[model samples]
Target: MTQLNEKLTLKQIEAIIEEMSIDGALNKLYAFKEEYGTKVDKLIVKYEKKKLQWEKEFKRFEDMRRYEKEAYSEGVKYIAGIDEAGRGPLAGPVVAAAVILPENVFINGLNDSKKLSEKQREKLFSEITEKAVAYEVGIVDEKIIDELNILNATKVAMEIAVESLKVKPDLLLIDSVKLDSLKIPQKSIIKGDSLSISIAAASIIAKVTRDRLLEEMDSIYPEYGFKKHKGYGTKEHIEAIRKFGICPIHRVSFTKNFTL
Candidate 1:
């Protein structure tokens, strides 16, 4: 019988279980196989599978760290990652974030903010800010989006977010938008938000900030369900816009389906 405090390697544990009855192994593995009722031998195999899964995650984090170091060595002291949210939405503000992460900071589960669960994004958002050197956000209302068009409006939001940062960045890692007017050196990667840790951090900030704005707008327009849709051109939202004939925040250019 293994002592309660006895720690064994996975292989050693499996070999011990194989020498004992399946029932004995099952009883021994109860601590590890909490939900699954597989035989001890099967549990050992399951552990191997889980180990491989975790290894992949470890590699991903390694890659992110490598890239972070490369960005730092380029002599770009404050490299801000810029990204925006609410571009596809019909209402609400287009929000952007610029994050300057600390050189030594590393968060375990950082990824594209869109790929993360809402709870995960929220958790990382806090962790990133607490560990970041500096961060800033910018927002442009739907009125501006409609007047300037989404593409230009998004650039406007991104520029403002970058300029607003207390720590002026020497380099910008933007997600697909190039700022020709800005003096700083910039890299516009198509999916920069997914590849760059700084960009992923920025995405989380922008997403949470924009989502909260829509949630607050819900209080003003209870009938439109802004909190859930975040002002996207949903069927229900289109119906509301049609009946209400557009609110101050509604993007008139995008309301073709609702225009009466």
Candidate 2:
């Protein structure tokens, strides 16, 4: 054991801890408790805490996928999750996403887009797309939003997203909106983004996609700070609109109440 300790560097110890399961880590901690010094002991404590947190997070993730598991039990194959972003934004388009994730799909750190930071959402967006059986995005610009009204425009976007999916889903788990027009069976859960893995994945995809579009729009309309607020009606955004007047992307209907 002393010889083994001499050969193991701090980096090597950390690497081993990273690869070990929680049980294995605990066994190693016990076996080397007396043989290792403070540095290794600290590493073990850190890894143990991290492993416990990971276990808790994984449990929550499984719980969030209860809707999907229920659908699977009902013999529904190819479950699609649908969600929309930018519905309440004062500018930019409302974007919707439809994603069909495979059964027993596991992606760590998946949660509601609103519950995550921009970096987390961006990372999950790529991960979801890579793992999804089929995914598609539908964008309805401010012009269409003004013409159709935000509610109808969002529904249209959702319809377009579902229709564009390469794979036909047997069931749709939606975030508080039923697509009655679509032939596919759907269940809309209130705040489904927080309760359903599929809806959460769809939320992340829609949010990331809309944020990207707003960033591009920021280049064209730097005054409104689309990149910063992502078209939300924050005081800064409202101030910008008031100073610059309505830009092309501003939904006239939404901003009509605003002094601008």
Candidate 3:
């Protein structure tokens, strides 16, 4: 076999690396290193780092699915994961999502919405919606949030989301809050979005849905920069509130401290 040398372009090596799975790519890189010690040195180092990253990510995804596996074992055919978004934002409605994913479903890069980049979350949002057995989103406007308080409003949204599911769930894996009103069996796991695949899917759905709403709100309240901060109380958002006063979408209770 001819040893690869400067005749082999870096781009060619990179393309080969991209086509293989993490383990396959790593093994091939190691073999290449053995054959052409310093010739493929840079490629070996790059793929070595990539292998570590892929391993860590795979472990995280495996851990996230533990809850779903347990539910599946216990004859829970449809397990819904529920989570909410926009709870802490100073503007926009609080949104909740309930998602029931197929048993043993695996989607690469699925994780808590907070742990993902915007682009990753967007990509996964579409994937989850398309692949889920059932999914529904519940949104409570700022008025309802202020009237009911964030906690109660979130509960209402969650319940609505659960009710909206086309496929009724046999079990509910909720993130940090159990709905007493819900007759379905449920487990409220703290940070379930990070610990449960279903909840992670719900978190992604809620986050993306609320973000899109806030983006539209940005058009109406251009002064608030909803598109940038997504209604979080950043210095810029607070400055906008102070400059333009509260918009119709601002949660009055949350913005009580502001002069508006």
The residue-by-residue lDDT of candidate 2 on 128-193, one tens digit each, is 999999999999999999999999999999999999999999999999988999998999999999
- Order by lDDT, highest first: 2, 3, 1
Estimate the Cα RMSD of every predicted model relative to the unseen true structure: 7.0, 1.9, 2.7
Q: Model 1: per-residue lDDT, tens digit, 139-219? A: 998888888999999999988998888898888888988988789988888888878888889999999999988999999
Residue 163 displacement in candidate 1 (angstroms): 1.1
Tens digit of per-residue lDDT, candidate 3, span 168-253: 99999999998999999999999888899999999999999999999998898898899999999999999888888998999999
Give candidate 1 regions above 4 Å deviation: 1-54, 65-67
Error of 1 at 141 (Å): 0.9
Judged by lDDT against the true structure, how good is candidate 2?
0.91
Q: Which stretches of candidate 3 lie over 4 Å from their true place?
A: 2-10, 26-38
Cα displacement (angstroms), candidate 2, residue 106, comes to: 1.3
Kindly give the stretch of ten consecutive residues in candidate 2 with the minimal lDDT sum: 30-39
Error of 2 at 132 (Å): 1.0
Where is the poorest 10-residue window by lDDT in model 1? 32-41
